[model samples]
Target: MAQNLMVCQFCETSNETKYKCANCDLILCEGCKIKIHTKIKKTEVHQVLDLKEFSNLSASETIRHLDLKDIQCSIHNAEHCIIYCEDCKLLLCAVCLLESHRTHNLTKIDEMYHRKVKELQELDSKLCEELPFYADLEKELKQIKSESEIKEIITKQRENIITELDRLWVPREEEISRQLKDTAEYCDALKRNKAQNEETFQSHNATAIFTASGKLDKDLPTRPANTISKQKILFSETRIPEDTKEVFGSVLTDPKCKITGSFTLNTEDSIYKIKTFENNTNILSLTKKSTIKSFELKHSKCNTTSI
Candidate 1:
């Protein structure tokens, strides 16, 4: 009814209506209502109420509305929707009310919303019952696939890990090979040096040779000139570490190059000096020599030194 509307019913001109008449079936503007209703003596006592209070009262029981200010009507773009069609399931504007949905069953948007909520609850129950079966079927399919591919997966993983390990170990293997080649070359050089030294010593024989029987060699009573006989080689002694030949006398060669001389270690100079007497009783006629030698060291961190 126009009573629920904001415009004054008497003039229908202004929307700034602040007052209305509750007893009568009429609404009035601010100026007209004040002049005719409040100030007039005869109708002054006529129980009149403001339009705001009248709006708060219930206009009708079946009448309803919806917030449709933003929703444009598809039928008329200039109009906004305020009603819903129950048969076609669409929103309707004021023009649609007169022309399109004149005979169609139209409803307020809020009532339609309640009806749709009921349908959604029924659909949700059906979904709740049907979704778990699909989920279980999906899980079964995934399990079958995983069981079939387990062997291939493990083999691929093993191959990948081994390839990575080999990649990391390549440098260490190269280092080992290089060191082995260097050691083999060094040993070959040392063997060649020893062979050369042995050849020189054998070709140029010693002139003065002493035996264990305290007898000296003579070339038919004319002795050859004595010179340095042996070349000295310095290295750590490992097989017999005791420094004294008496400790292993059982294994010593008694008559091999008999040394009829006294040997002493000169610790201050780290050298062994030997004194030889020409005759057993003549301590004055002695020959002394320091057995000192220089050698090259081929030590590396790859192995422990051994002699």
Candidate 2:
């Protein structure tokens, strides 16, 4: 009844409405809706709606579509697909298995779907467990980098100290050498002065002898000859000062700076001995003029110094 007679809600034209607008739900007639109503004063904003009703559709028949399968296989006219054959690349029914998929690998679509779902869940769990390990590894690497930076700074500081010490070392050594040379020269000058004074006294004594002989004294005057042997100046046994050596013996005698006296054997023994030291000890012994073929140093040992 709604589809047989058409009525325009805007113009009230019974059985004369043909075109209707679906958006605004307004019906329209040919003469009054378009020609007459388009010219109306206040109806310019009205749109139209088109309606269609099917008489064969019932309430129960519309709900029956819920139980029906909308999709069908083109090969089988009435069968629903639940498995896909990979070898043949086709859908198959349960009864068609022995005929078409006997020798092929058959897979259920539902099974594949569930397997994919479970795989995604396992991947998520693995990623969660690995996250903390990756973060800890990154943190350890950062700490290692920080420690290396600190070591580099310490090395640079040590290099700076070595440079400054080297600068002070050269001139100080030259001054010590100059003092030693001056002490030797002073000892030489004193010996020369003593010889000159002795010569003068001897000359006066000879003159007196000549005077006494010419005067014809009965007693002959005897003169003692001046015998003076040059005394050798001995260097200090300890290179460092006496008080300093006693106070710093433990530190200095570390065998590094100690210079021991040389010992040599007679022709029968023909042995030369050199002591071991700390700094440059191995190098010095390797090139020393000693009879021993090879030497091994034993520190913290209690005994006399041996050849």
| Best candidate, TM-score | 1
Those runs of model 2 whose alpha carbons end farther than 4 Å from true positions after fitting are 1-82, 85-102, 157-307
Clashes of 1: 0
Residue-level lDDT of model 2, residues 159-269, one tens digit each, is 544344345333534543444344334334434433432232222121221122223222211211321111211112233475563321111111223343433322233
Clashing pairs in 2: 21-48, 21-49, 21-50, 26-49
Q: Model 2 lDDT vs. the true structure? A: 0.40
- Count steric clashes of candidate 2: 4
Global Cα RMSD, each model: 49.0, 49.2
- Given candidate 1, what's the lDDT at residue 269? 43
lDDT of each: 0.42, 0.40
